[model samples]
Target: MADLDGDFESAESGASETYPQQCSALRKNGHVMLKGHACKIVEMSTSKTGKHGHAKVHLTGIDIFSGSKHEDICPSTHNMDVPNVCRKEYQLNNIDDGYMSLMDENGEQREDLKVPANDLGREITKKFDNGETFNVTVLKAVGNEAVIGIKCQTS
Candidate 1:
């Protein structure tokens, strides 16, 4: 007999990560779950019904945090997972060992995010080294979050 004693309860077990949405109702620039990634729909088109099949909706999306592309096709009447995505801004506080310290408007601090290893990271580092105060935009979805943008604080 196989053992099954491991506790697999997740911290967000009580929260629903995604909601069901009809494929045909999803629009471009909306949020979607493609291949297990939370993405923003960049392009969408519906193809006419085939010989004995229903109409298909083709989707092309970009992963909001990772900037990766994902695509999929499904019958227009089928249901698809639409992730609950949220964006929040925080004041940049510090950076150390590739991790960043950020403070929210209420002064709550968060230090769990890593500096992206892409062009954005380089830009962030440069701005920080130059002593430019800025706000970081963090995108959260599907139990994951990341710093997606930065904006200088204006007078």
Candidate 2:
């Protein structure tokens, strides 16, 4: 509905979570999207051009957050989606019932986030139980965020 004041709200909401890049340009130890999951490239190989036409790029990557492996094959000239990954540090305020209360450098706090179910998550839980202070490193990409690393805070 149009208002008399002609006011409208725009929501971008990270519309471009990923960008397209030629498969030939992708490199080892880089980031890419395979099978609709954001992953970190671990191995890549290109097959020589054959009767099939353009050379085929074979990619093998591990999911950034899930740790599951994904494989993909595409023409070298084809484009692949690359996730825009970022990391931030947050202070560990508290953990209640397997949920984390985290505060960022700007002092903004977020609660009720479930602890990641992985090795890093276990380490964070163990450290917090001992009354230690540290900052957690959060990795964000494609609308997904996870606690990936930790830095001990010195008082």
Candidate 3:
């Protein structure tokens, strides 16, 4: 019998682990990187295999921030990269020509950020004009960040 207990060892203390995933494992509403763009998968379909080929998977996704649609086809067994996504809350501080400033929970300010094009974005625009400090949800993935939604703070 082989020593199976020691076969699985933990990685380096602070090193993050990332692995490729098969196309068939993807699901709708999942975040993935397509053509170097961070997108959220909106639809997915798989086709039966032909005479001598493998099954093909069709994926349609939209840019999380830009709302642009992108589609691609790949073998069901094909490997795809999945991006790490995070969401955080922040407060609107100011708005510039094409960017808005935000302050985090720790009072740290980030300026000159383009507002996303979505309901939350529209709400932010409307609230900013009235000098309101609303809570904003930011989605971070694949080294990019964008505003996803706004939260109304209640006293």
What TM-score, over all chains together, does every model reach? 0.88, 0.87, 0.74
lDDT of 3: 0.82
- State each candidate's clash count: 0, 0, 0
When sorted by lDDT, best at the front, the candidate numbers are: 2, 1, 3
Worst 10 residues of 2 by lDDT: 6-15
lDDT of 2 by residue, 59-115 (tens): 999999888999999999999999999999999989998889999989999985688
lDDT of 1 by residue, 7-109 (tens): 9775555768899999999999999999999999999999999999999999999998778999999999999999988899999889999999999999999
Q: lDDT of each structure?
A: 0.92, 0.93, 0.82
Ranking by TM-score: 1, 2, 3
| Superior by TM-score: candidate 2 or candidate 3 | 2
For each candidate in turn, give its C-alpha RMSD to the true structure in angstroms.
Answer: 3.2, 3.0, 7.3
